[model samples]
Target chain A: MKPHPLAGALLIAGTVPIKDFPLLLGKAEREGDFLLVDGQRIPCTQGTAAMVTAAVAALDYLNLDPPMALLAGDVGEGRGSRAIYDFLSRELREFSPKVLSLHYLLPIITPMKKVISAVQGCNPRPVLIADAGSMYAAKAAGLATEFDVFTPDAGEMAFLADSEATHPAYIKRYLFEADSKEVPRLIGQAYGCGNAAQTLLVKGVVDYIARNGEILETVREPDVPQMEAIGGTGDTITGLVSAFLQAGLEPHEAAIIAAKANRMAGKYANPTPATRITEIIARFPEAFKDHLCEWSGVCTVESRLRPATGGARQGGEA
Target chain B: MGLFKDKSSSRGRGLTLFKEVKEALKAEKILKVSGYEVKLAAPPPSLRKGCDLAIEVDLMGQAGVERVLRQNGVEFDRIVSIDTEELEPLRVVKVTDFGDSMMVRAGNMKVAFEKATGIILNVSGGGCPDVPYLHLELLNKKITEAPRPCELGFTLCALMLDRALDEGVRIYEEARG
Candidate 1:
């Protein structure tokens, strides 16, 4: 697929512990195990840092501009989450992004509603993707349908399938028992209950991409069993798919390619149970170089050599 | 006395309701151990049902608290901000008794054990990759002696398995006593 003119901000929003309330915005860079953004170092071992680092790496590999990150230091406290919500409510119009990926924020309904309202007010509405805490909040607030994509693991799928489940832990016993084999059923149940996004990238042993309760595609290749044990592999897939969506790939296509690339990246990393998510992410550039052409029907790998324009903080040092 | 004083002074307080008082107690222990500032509190009159107990938590860290609770397999009905509208907690576990054995289920995980010996007969359910590994670790062990599922595995399945195991042990102890 030929890349479109990179338009608007490719934005990632989440929380990490570095301070209390101030929202930090800048191009994200991975330095060692930490994600450095605007002089603030966020650990990449888990949560939003891992997701944003993988996304920044993928965009960088594609020679696209790195993502602009909106981060706060929220160590499970509400202050940083409130800060992020306040910023989005007050500044999202001015900081309109083309694609906004939400991760690891406290799942409070009022703030999430405010943030959604701010996002909806953007001149050109952003493609909204949610995972982890954001996804849970969206579902809890009955706003999952507002998102373009939700990247959920099997456990999360169970939560979505049970219309009454406000959180994964509280899903009905029968639904939880359904497991991965019940993903297709759960997808249908989620859509039936109006608790599903426009597109569901259900990540599991076999990644399933579904739209409107209909299965679009499945990618189970390049099997990397060790990837399951590694924390943040799901987050990395969410990051890659977010970048692909921002880069103008269709939602289903982005989901498919990202699933394959994540597995391939794992293969390239030759990961073990002890492997960190960053190691798999470090292989994204090589994995993309080897497969982007074939996957997207992009004419040549040479095209990737040319730097893309219009990315957030283009040409700025991290 | 000062330190033990109900630290429920945070402006943004939330309550986690469970189906049983035992569930609430278990969740409180898990949350405290996980570094959350939480306390067991009586559910408001409007919220009381099967369980009179509820866990009070700082609303600000609700997401983190919920994640930890879920990770450790502490099943709760719903976490509601104290200021929000009352929502009822759902009872998700079911205990079924057979002549020789009993099964306790929480979410997708089930623990069945011989009644006389409390030896685990089967551990099943959950779709996470860790389920099979956890199943192996818990099978054939006495409910009280089996390792906690959350300690041995890292998945929602493991958490649910832990929930089942916890319930199973409680039932066995109650029967014996």
Candidate 2:
């Protein structure tokens, strides 16, 4: 079955790097932090470049034609941080995005609430993807349940397990140090406290998808051990989940496909500690082909996911 | 005067029904299974048109809940509007200054900050998972430089902290003057 480019827009909220994305090999632009979307410049404040990079990579995989505007923002420090809330409110109200990804906001409490309010006000509530620092914010703000899915690493899994602690830093050492098999224990603990979201994509050596405290599926194939050293891989997973969800896949299917696609992309990149994240992301388009086939169960390619004239990489900067 | 005011009695709008304990419980289960937000409440004695056990449902879910009840053959009394106006109003926050530090209290949440440096000293209150983290992030940071609690918080506890933080900043500015 051919994958469909999502009709609904994918809006990513997170941090950006100190340089403009689509770097020239080893060189970063001398210009300060900013994001270039289709050659238009937007100020990058609080989000990370890794997040935007991953979202772009996922879009490449999905083959979204004439790529839609990616509304990404940086939550600035101090008084400027309020701008994050204002930005989210304005965009969420106007765009009515199908998927709203909350990623990498500062630990400050004020802006977190504002973002939640803006999201709550959105009509036809978006399928929310919360990851990294945003996961902490969502869980901390007690908005974890409001999100459709949470992508947490092993360490983050421990944080989620500790219902007593607000921050991962405060989570009990035992919980954080527990083995992978014990993940179900932590999921139980978090669920007991009503802290867990509707769906959890716990990413590690093994990626497990759990709904309502029950582990539904686990994706463990094509695991690249070295992918751990490469930062932004988790961010890439969040992006893929958002993109897949926008494409109308259920949370369970999206999580599974994203996990498989990410590992597949890493295998394609064949990275060591030396491999940059960008190279791994570049591989998503091709990696998605095989995975989408697995997802659809039909042998033939659908026109929706067919590569464009110039090919997939031409879609956006990953 | 009666303890409750008679508002609109339109079953098409927000309404809940009270049957016997077992029936009410069954209706609650059926409505919830059908995905209606159902809450158990004691219907005001003055309006005791049914059993003591009443299920309060959101106005939007009224039709769906009624349909489910009808489909399940769950018997219920006429639905009634809740006198929302009689509910207690929001609590007012209080601010206290200790010269060296200041504290603001709103409901279950409190935020304290040092006066001289304008940095936040501590944030406390709420059982939500986010409170301890919010406290960790805000602790020992200069209030003026600190992130607004409202932006980072998602629960009533977080909102209360934001309120306290707002007052703490206000008091800090006053102290400076």
Q: Per-prediction DockQ scores? A: 0.08, 0.02
**Best-fitting candidate, scored by TM-score:** 1
Candidate 1 off by > 4 Å? A1-7, A18-22, A300-309, A312-318, B1-177
- What is the C-alpha lDDT profile of model 2 across A1-318, one tens digit per residue? 322233246666554322122211010111233445656454322123445555555554455432243332222221222344457755565556667776654334445666778778876677788875567666765667777899887657876876644444345556645777888788887777777888999887899999888889998988786565344577678777876676567788788888988899999998653345567767877886656777644423233333332334343322
Q: Which ten residues in a row have the lowest lDDT in candidate 2 chain B?
A: B1-10
Worst lDDT window (10 residues) for model 2 chain A? A22-31
lDDT string for model 1 (A166-217, tens) is 5565565566567568899899999999999999999877999998889999
| DockQ score for candidate 2 | 0.02
Assess the local accuracy of residue A23 in candidate 1 as a C-alpha lDDT between 0 and 100.
80
Q: What is the TM-score of chain A in candidate 1?
A: 0.91
Candidate 1 colliding pairs: A1-A296, A1-A298, A78-B60, A177-B108
Interface RMSD of 1: 10.7
Q: What is the per-residue lDDT of model 1 for residues B1-177, given as tens digits with 9 covering 90 to 100?
A: 011112423433668888888888889888777667677889888777678999987543444566777778887887775643323222366666656777776754566788899987665433332443455566668889998876655334455667778888888999999
